[model samples]
Target: MSRYETVIGLEVHAQLKTKTKIFCSCSTEFGKDPNENVCAVCSGMPGVLPVLNEKVAEYATKMGIATNCEINLKSVFARKNYFYPDLPKGYQISQFELPICEHGHVDIEVDDEKKRIGVTRIHMEEDAGKSIHSAADNASFVDLNRTGVPLIEIVSEPDMRSAEEAIAYLKEVRSVLLYLGICDGNMEEGSFRCDANISVRPYGQEEFGTRAELKNLNSFKHILKAIKYEVDRQIDLVEDGEKVVQETRLFNVDKGITQSMRGKEEAHDYRYFPDPDLVPLVLDEAWVKQWQSELPELPRDKRERFMVEYTLADYDAALITTDRTVAEYFEAAVKAYNGEAKKVTNWVVGELLPFCHEVESEACDVKLSPEKLAALLTLVDDGTISVKIGKDIFRDLCESGDDPAEYVKAKGLAQMSDSGELEAMVDQVIADNPSEVEAFKGGKKKLMSFFMGQVMRLSKGQANPGIVTKMIQEKLS
Candidate 1:
């Protein structure tokens, strides 16, 4: 219970996955040879008029609908005046007074308590180019390939109280964009980026402390660390009778501290005005409804549905729904095996995710497809193999891309479930380990694991573990 309460709001810029730059015919491919993908229009040569790309509007409106935002039928795009070497036009064209969407909300959970954060507006904009600095030579380079790329800036209300909430809100927005397929959601590649505005006030104070902008937080870990440090710095300033200043700050990755970059700018500072070259974007009600109906089920909705329909717990549902392909993979296996979602979830979350991590590939990219995973789980379900042997079988199937049933039969990995054969082995085990058996009968119940281990070792790791446990209990009792 500190005397201060932190307030946070996030602005996420998601570059839409359009084939071409928003207002030009230039290709939007990344990692092109520096300025290779640039054209006269994208590079902002004089006497060239901009033509709006319909796909940009389509993607932005789709995101608005997905985030439960109000779609402004007649949204205007304005010129945001700024002069930087990377901004080839000297002024970036963006939406201002009449943005494409407004009044949206995203719900997030922290410590199992749900909160709906308000989205103030979602506006369309064109991305500026990159500025490259050379290490060998003391010179700067500007690459205009990224200029004129379609972007939608999602502005959130200042509802977050801590780093966890801000991050949860950011992740939810990224997931929605990813699910929509409008954005690649790659933060490292600059496809998705966030700038946070943070402020603090006394616990019962009605006025807010001046906020500082935190920029260039590429990773989640960096974002979290930055917020924690910023909040503490503001609280300290207030306690020391120092007033916090409104300025832009950069998060230093190596030093793990935020340094002031520049003073925060207001909307009026951008000198926004409607572009005379381009007309207003007028979306009809029928057209907006069409895209709304076509929107995919978002991550949050999918997570909730999994909990109810698949009978999965909150943690499993969240883990599986973290990415679209992972959720699809889980659903495919469940459908193939005809239910048993809990078992499927356990394997997918416990086994599949880690395997994907080890290979440094997406879960959907694995050779172990849903059908194959279903087959492996079926082998365990039918008692053809024990869980221990299934581990080996799963690994072999992944490595060799072989069918599970064939692999089991070819490798002699089937669980030996025969009672008579197992009983004889149990007798041999009990007879050989007299001291352990005596210890087991002398009220040492925990020694059952030792007997089970010996039986497994004697059976060459093919013994049915459940049957071994039963036989050991019968003999010991």
Candidate 2:
């Protein structure tokens, strides 16, 4: 271990799943034509007064409650002054001194050890437009479609000590956002993105080393790699008797290094002042209560319930509960199957999840409905189809959403349990491989697997292994 320790804090910006801009009626749709979704308010036209979207405030409050944050009865929006081509207003409307949420925390587990990462604040802000650069043409274009999109910036305390801890904390927070159905958590499309603040100090030091803020970490894999790279880079500077610069850096994904973008700015640099056009957002107690009442079972709670109620292993429970749709699918399937929960878990985690990932869709959107999945698993459990046959037909089941029993009958895919048929296949295997049969009789009982494979192949993976094994053993023994 190195003598120095790494401290990391993350600022995650999650785009609200709202329909319109935070302060305007313009659509908050992604991938629209340039400026198509823009209006005078979002485009920063002169003399246009901004109107606060009630849905934005409500969404922000829901997130605050879900994260265990203290919901401020009154929060003020301030103009964050900045100059960028994408920021058409020359200043962005954001919350500073009186953010909507504060003093929240998320618990994360790293290497089987639990740690709580404090959420310093979750402030609501309006997003700036995208600046698409055309390197070939040596020009940049601004798309105001994303302007004024509602965002909640979740800032964490510098409580993490390692990259592993940082990643675990990020994943936990993202899981919560996904479970709440507030943010889509699509890191690739920038719905959810994180910036890392990294510093290294000696083992006994009380003061922190100069920190570098890493940006452009759009994915979790990139975040982990960037954090590790930045930590090592800072340590190298310190060891070489060079002072670390406090600056903003962008991760060069291809080079796997952080390059300085610009010097970091202090909060006072933004010249934060409350916007006069919009009144202070005062959330009513009744409204807060209603939002709180609407809160679904969060990820941690659902994970715990899965363990106790479903008797799932911790790892399996974590996988199922990571996404709300997947968790709901599991419960619905279990209820529909009305069988062992672990059995449903196996098909879910082992088969269904892989298909979901492959198709880049959630379980809720997939063709394999919970009832359909339950029916398929029921066929496997009832011995109507062998496990191997179930595996073979799973993709078809997922695509066609066909009744498993009906599909089996239509495809002639039922398990072959007849004594006469299985015995003939087993005898044929024994006759075909005399040396293997002799070896089995001479204490090479493991050759039973070899015969079983042949019999299963003859039946096209529909042979009932239980009866086939009994017949093969009786003949060979």
Candidate 3:
């Protein structure tokens, strides 16, 4: 049997987070009643003129600049003719030949290797209305609220070799969009959706095999599964002497398989023509430079900075910079601690992160400020509080945002690091646990742990365990 390789490309439609619809004055709010947000312009009523939204163009330009794409100085919208009841317009206004961006690429890290995936084009388009189908009643309902919502469809070249690379590309693209604030990148609410074109070919073969388009993949997990299943299905079909047909398929997440929707249509099938209602969008180099200057330090740059400046490991840098809020929080904490990178990372990852997840709050909104957290860690470092006591105080600070120093003083949780005091405590503990002491003398070194625990309990968890253990070892010997 010959081994086959899978090749995949993705068309990611990310709904721009604008306040109003693309070509209308209606609110672009999601979750509204069906057709409530629709207007004559979005509904595709005859004689309705579609005025272009300037923000949409700015966002598209921003994405183009961010992805290192060639921004088309002039881009035009073309009507994509189709007859779907959900699309109030008999034709969807989309860009075909002259898209806003072309020949861009984003670098993605998959399995510790960096790969650049080529972006064929990023075009501006208006979304079609959603159709909800009922399984039991076999009826479909239309929601036009999403119709006319602005979107930038980022089409990637078929450069991905596996499902993992495809997912990494999707994640990097989504992260860039989110950081740019052009799109919210929420997959669940249809704000960000992906359609994958996947095919399988024999290893070392140059010609591409038959490809299937998988739609309705809302989440990253589903995209991976759907692509893998489709690849396997196509490879199996070729192995069984059956040809893989070119068709659009829907991924049934519940069933974990792709079902055929319709045969693929060529681009000319849509009868594309310039939209008469909308004029060509002419962007000057000055405007593109403005949006480019406003772009934030993207994920890759921030990740590298964290590693170099803060001495964070790759995983730590990656985690801290995954979201803007988390990244800012980590940076602020580091600044407060005078560049105690490891301590800041430990507190943020170990304590602040779990607390944020538990309370369903953002890390930026956590009660403890980075300054206070740094101060708390300083207390542990200076032996003002033991590590265990510092943890307790840190939890209190997280709950109340209290000053760590004040809390430690009020709670009497300061560490008893004075050698005289800790030594006396350890001696008392050994005298009290005579039998355990005998076990230690008889080579049951594990009893040392018991002695330390007793000392910690006696000190109310304020004794420095390191000092206590050393003193106990000297006394026993």
Candidate 4:
């Protein structure tokens, strides 16, 4: 028996975030009435000449520069001939021989090791329409609304050895697209979709094995599972003296199985040819350089900077920089209040994150602005309010966007930080919890927590816990 290794490559199709469909004037909005966003060009009516969307080219160029790809000076669109009810044009206008980008790479961290995955090509293409299958009956319907929408298919080399690597690569790519504002990167809305090509071969084998293309893996978790299952399935076939067949398979997320869609179509199967209707795209050095300047700091660089500048750990930086909105929010909070890194991080990660999810909003729309959060943290730091009381005021600020210090004073929620006031409260707590006081005297110093709890309850959670604890220890001693 020969040992085997799994090899996987990914082909990710990301829809560019443009206002209108490529080559047409149709609105590129999702969830419109079926075909409501379609127009004559997108619907493939007769006698319409396809006009190129300039923004698509700019987006492609931006992605190419970001991924370290070579921008093709001239790229051509070709006719991918296929017949499907959803595709009104009967052929998708896409780049085949000459794509907008080539030979790029993205570095992904897997198992604490950074591995570079090679990007074979990134090509521009028009999307096909969507097909809707009815649950009530054995009926299927087609919607041409998405037809002629612009997409860039990023093809990666077979450089991944495990499912983790594949998912990391996918996440990194999605983050790049989102950071660039080129794609919304929504998997559920079909804005960013991924199809994987996977195979298994003996360890150190030079030749590759038969590969299966898996599609409809919408989420990151599903992608990981699908790749793992496919790898196992292929290895099992080889072990049982069977050969893995080359085919296109669809992942049934609910069933957790891959079903064959069709025999895998080779490149020649589509009979690719330069589209006669549209002219070749020509990009100059000046044009490419202009788009390059617009590129922001990508995920890797941003993550490192966050770690260095804010003294955050790798996980914290990764979480903060995963989305552009979160990163901006964090930076704003840091700027608003000087040298309160940990406080800002706690509120952003703990309170703001859950609040965003609760209201079903992106981080960009977080009701508690970074300046406001910083102000709240400052209130706690300056002893204007206890940490517990600050949290309550912060929640009110999140709801009403009011000033934290003013809210605390107006609501009489300020901490009893005066030594005289807290001393009296500490005495009451010590008298009430005699067992805890005895325990503390007997060297079970952890009973300090019990005394602290009683103090908090007596103060109605308005006492400064640090002051109360210190005053209690002094009085008890």
Candidate 5:
């Protein structure tokens, strides 16, 4: 039996998809030259005032609404004083006491049991500049391009019991971010990032355990592994009668361990105080309502709709609606093919997904469009090509973006639906495989598949499987 229960909460910082920085007019675009996107306000030059970006508030409210957070009509920005080199201002302007949104929850399921994880608060803040290290040159560089990027910090309650639950929650949160068009949720590029505060308590205990905050876990796999390692480390400390220190730790992805970075600091250590330069934001009730009205159909709603309207199985619906682009691709193909939802689902999930994985990209980067996929499915439905050959054509579409019909015609890969030709091949297979035929006549009904395989092989896999099955069954009976 396990001795302890793991508890995890995540602090997710997602860079909002705004065109400009939170306070300054500097560009928020990623992958720009170091310091090129910086400005006097964002780079913290002397005597510059910061102005709020209206779009950041709008996006944050959209998220709060989506996550069921209460919109705080009035909120204040505070200065969190810190001394990291990347912090140009020697402090970060953030929301501390009065955040923009509060008391929300996100639902996640693990092992078929649904759990509601409470979101503590969602506050708007500005991102710090990045510090680039170079081991070869023994030097570090600073890039202020991301210095003033708008970010929303989503702090969750310590409600997760295991790594699986944590991952499920993160995925849902990321999906919501994507669906709202607020963030790209790209961990590689730091658009979306997570820091986990994890601890392990004795099972059934009401009090919480000593926790360590794990940072630098950029990917889902990294999150899972880091949580697992931290939990085990804490539990072992307890069993050994050693005290677990509360501190900040960094995940060493290469070594699969967490090392202490610094002692955890209390809120007072940062000297949190209201920013005197910026005025408290007073949001209009009408404006908040307008933002809510413009909210798009979120991922969970879209998943349920896909199951109902598309008449899809629960698994199919979940997989199709997991990503916005993939969901749109499924719907577009279904529409173009005139509502053959199940057929299109099969092709997209089975064939197109593997092709995407092979090419190291997502559905959005796919070269095959819905119109082409619809045309390919039409060929299979009309018996112009076997589903087997259509799979081959799907591969061609994935690789080269060629038209499916043109590929089939150019390669002479049309299905052999001609009854006379299939019948002759079926008879020849029956004669050549006398033992199998006798076994089938003697009661081995499964031998029909053996004969069908032979017929299909004889037809070079171009035979319409339906027609060949019918023709083969007739000759054998």
Candidate 6:
């Protein structure tokens, strides 16, 4: 424990999945040739004017409703003036005075304690282009393809007291975006990114200390590392009687330290003014109601429901409900199996999830369907195949999408449950391991596992464990 308390707030930029740019008709598709998606409006031509994309408003409003925000009936767009090579337009259009959403909050759990973090606002804006630097040529290039892309910046209050709480809150927000199907939530591709503002003060101080904004935090690992490093730096400066300056710093991935980028600017520095071309956006009541109706069950609600409906433990329910697709997959598998929900939960969480992760795909996109997985589990339920054998062939079934019963029959991998055959195998194992048998009869009952291991090896993992255990006990007794 330290004498200072850490305060953290996150600003997240999530690129909306729209077919075209926010203010222009140019396609928003990524990974095309340089300037392939550019147009007169997006390129900032002299005579072009921007038109708001209706779909962008709908998406933003839906997010606001999902976060328990108050959807303002009318909002204004203002020009955020700045100078950069990637920003072709001298001023980027963003909302400042009255955003579309305000006064919202989301709940998160850290260390088994639930906390609600305040969402100050979620506002819409246009994204700037990319700047690519070529070391060989000793030059930098700008690609305007990403210019005019739609984004919503969710700003959180300084409600987090530690990095763990900040991360938990971020994950909760990302999960909501994913569940709403409004954003792709891809951190590596820049579709989803974060900027963290950190400050430190004495444990009882009410006033906040000078803060530093950290940028270039691409992934969660980098965010966590940056927060930890920045917190310590601020504390050291305070203890040494040095002032912590307010500025923007970039996190160097290799060095794992923050380097000052530039002095942080206040809103007045930008000279913000209402855009002359675009008018105030007034949302219709019916339109807002329609979006509200279409909102799907959020992650937290679904997680609680899974616990009561399926009798799942908290860990299993939380893992399954983290993503909407995985939850749907679990429900579909359970419906098809019509057996113990826990049994289906075990296979889905233990086997299917790992396989999907290894192949880099979602639960819905995996080659193995829920029905096929239920079929595989059914074979084990009926004693037609051993549990070990089912696990061994799971990967192959996921890849090939073969029928479980047919594959078991074709490969001669059925469990050895016949009385005479199992008895003989058990007898041979006892005769071979006489010392182990004597040990078991002499009260080293744990040796029963050793006998079972031998029988399983002899039968090539196809032995019925229950029957083998019974026969080994009788012979030894």
Per-residue alpha-carbon lDDT of candidate 1 for residues 18-112, written as tens digits (9 for 90 to 100): 99988988999898898999988988899998999999998999999988899999988899998899998899999999999999999999999
- Top-down lDDT ranking: 6, 1, 2, 5, 3, 4
Q: For model 2, what is the alpha-carbon lDDT of residue 36?
A: 96
Ten contiguous residues minimizing lDDT sum, candidate 1: 391-400
State the lDDT at 460 in candidate 4. 88
Candidate 5: regions farther than 4 A off: 357-367, 398-403, 427-450, 474-477
Which stretches in model 1 have alpha-carbon errors above 4 Å? 418-428
| Candidate lDDT values, in order | 0.91, 0.91, 0.88, 0.88, 0.90, 0.92
lDDT tens digits by residue: candidate 4, 94-136: 9999999999999999768999999999999999998999989
RMSD of each: 1.8, 1.1, 2.7, 1.9, 2.2, 1.3
Top lDDT prediction, candidate number? 6
Question: For candidate 2, what's the RMSD?
Answer: 1.1
- Model 3 misplacement above 4 A: 134-138, 357-360, 389-400, 407-412, 416-439, 442-450, 457-460
Model 5, position 114, has a per-residue lDDT of 83
lDDT of 5: 0.90
lDDT of 2 at 260: 96
**lDDT winner, 2 or 6:** 6
TM-scores, one per candidate: 0.95, 0.98, 0.91, 0.95, 0.93, 0.97
Give the clash count for model 1.
0
